[model samples]
Target: MRRLRNDLPYTFRPARPKDWFRPPALWLNRHWLLERKYRVTAIEEQGFERVRELDATGDSMLLAPNHADHADPHLMMEIGRRYELPFHFMAAREVFEVSKRASWALQSMGVFSVDRDGPDVSAIKMALSILAAGKPLVLYPEGEIYHHHERLDPLHEGVASIGMKACGRVSEGRQVWLVPVGMRFLHDPSVEATFRDRLTRLEDRIGWTPKPKMDLDERILRLGQGVLGLKESEFQVNVAAGGIQDRLESLCGQLLEMVEARMGSDGAAGTAPERVRAMRYRIRRRLLDVDHPPGEDERTLLLDDLDRVFAALQAHSYIGDYLLAEPTLDRRAETIMKLEEDLLGFPLYPSARTARILAGEPISISEMLQRGELPRKGGASALTSLLEERLSRLIEVPAGAACSTELVSRQSGETG
Candidate 1:
């Protein structure tokens, strides 16, 4: 049998209430498990000192960060160590359910579960408890890793809702702060070659042969169009062409329409990410629990439906790369990484890449309440958009940075 590398080990602890924030074990995990083992090159701090100031004031806080990659949680831990702040993190229950030992370790480290697919009241209460205690809680609003560092996925409204609700729970004198954090992954320039090689390998594996002298943009367009084209064919979609973004959007809309039609559901409104979330919520209602466990044939049919749902979600999550109009070398490299991850199911980038942890100015719950933003109808949606806007600005790669657009241009088809 082939051997697979295992994750870091942890000792088990009985589930109970404890001082989860101030654990000496977390620092050890950050040093040995995250930085040393995972090779996190450096965390470029931006506006982190502001968080330090907030900590000194003893304000209750929740961090809503953009989820770009798998390493974000660990990177945030390292950030916490540097700032001398301990935080409680909200994690998906399935992570704790991976193994008993893993569950115990994470739970010991001030991590609590929030069921993403369903209403978990206990999890909600736990989050409120932490906030009411005046401790900082890190809640990722994006909900899952979308693998685009510069893009902010549509946020889940739960973050804003919880923050406002927790604010109300706090004493009149105390404040609950919602801090927006942007985790941007930056890699070495040499990785451009790596990206190209990887893309070439993927193209070969998928049996795609680009026309001679194709520019980088054209090649990328062709590759993306090809993938989308296949999915369209599978769904019996009439081919629509108007560059990558237009066609991809149309295809996803059609797919979602088909999904909603099958489920006897309507209201496929909002952006792709929003539609996907709504669709998944409906899907969960059907699949979450069955009184009787399904037979083999029943399980296969159920699995097929799930596969389609997830595929649609992924298509929605990933199409944001089209937003990059000025594709620099860094942007192009990251795009290739996206392709590698999406196509070959590979890591987005090497582990040794530097992560820029950008913390925007914390939004004051008191101020928001006074401004009539909190507790208002559609307030959560508005606040989420505001947070997302802050994150988008924070992750913006400087246009003046030394990146070779020529490299990308050279790789494109002649028409590009």
Candidate 2:
């Protein structure tokens, strides 16, 4: 067993393969694990043969999939089996800590641990080695699962950076390609009944009574108002009189400004998402900076500041009930799921839903480099846009479908 050293980041270690690789076990487990747990009815694959064709050419490929649900990685596992391709996935370190058995199984399935809160060279080196060996690497650029289906969040540059950097080290004629994979989990129709029941239970649990005549949107608005009122009281900010969206925006702005002031930042420009992201980056850097560790009081203060910032960020996602605007079956189900998750602090994984995995035409790193499309400045942003565009095109939503307008958190945003 590999051990984390004192010199390394907490839980950091070189990626290690398990004692065995059991393809049949993994394939069987995928069928039972995802279906039984998440109730995924069927996984429809589009253009999967193209990926097989690319693999046949012996060129390295990277799988960059948008993460909207926790079941995404499991879906990818099943896809790997169907395509007859084994790929390595970079999972957050917390997953491995769930249990020794889970860690072993994950490692055997070509999963490596990533410390996303800070830079970890060990994980990057492992990724490069996987690409150099002509193996496919599955890296979700979104970093975290957003649970907001139909909406594509902003992409992180890490996926492009790792793939491009590895491609640069390839021998003369070989090429590396980044495949944009989009996974869309359609909501189960029965979610409406379940949603009403769950929301009723939540209201009861909180000892809050709703009007008998309230509609779905009205109830959502009421819940939002109650939650926002509590937060405003906690923060000692005066309740601003406005529409739900306006009030939410104002309150969140105030909360964030509090953190920024404490951190010595003005945040004069940029959208709320951008400001929250910068604050998080600064907080994480300070918290994880090994060169100069904070003293006891300083550490306590920093932790408290981070807690407040995260709370404010969480509040930002619930603004305006983006799911209620369209009121389509899909939107209703998504909104219901989001509300349940917000109340329950986890995913519901609604039942009998079809998941579509569409692989877009692979983006060629060599071709992009040759065309001078990549720049030292903003290269990752350009690449992120290209991948997001490709994946977004693959997702088909109804003409009037709309989702929450919450700004995608930079640290946790997922591409389409």
User: Lowest-lDDT window of 10 residues in candidate 2?
Assistant: 1-10
Q: Which 10 successive residues of model 1 have the least lDDT summed?
A: 1-10
> lDDT of all the models against the reference?
0.67, 0.70
Q: Across residues 202-241, which tens digit of lDDT does each residue of candidate 1 receive?
A: 6886788744456776677677767777777776766677
TM per model? 0.81, 0.83
Q: What lDDT tens digits, residue by residue, belong to model 2 across residues 280-322?
A: 6567667678899877797777766665565565566553656
Q: Which stretches of candidate 2 lie over 4 Å from their true place?
A: 1-9, 210-213, 238-241, 264-298, 319-321, 397-416
Q: Which stretches of candidate 1 lie over 4 Å from their true place?
A: 1-39, 208-217, 266-269, 292-299, 320-324, 371-377, 397-416
TM-score of 1: 0.81
- Model 2 residue 240 CA deviation in Å: 4.9
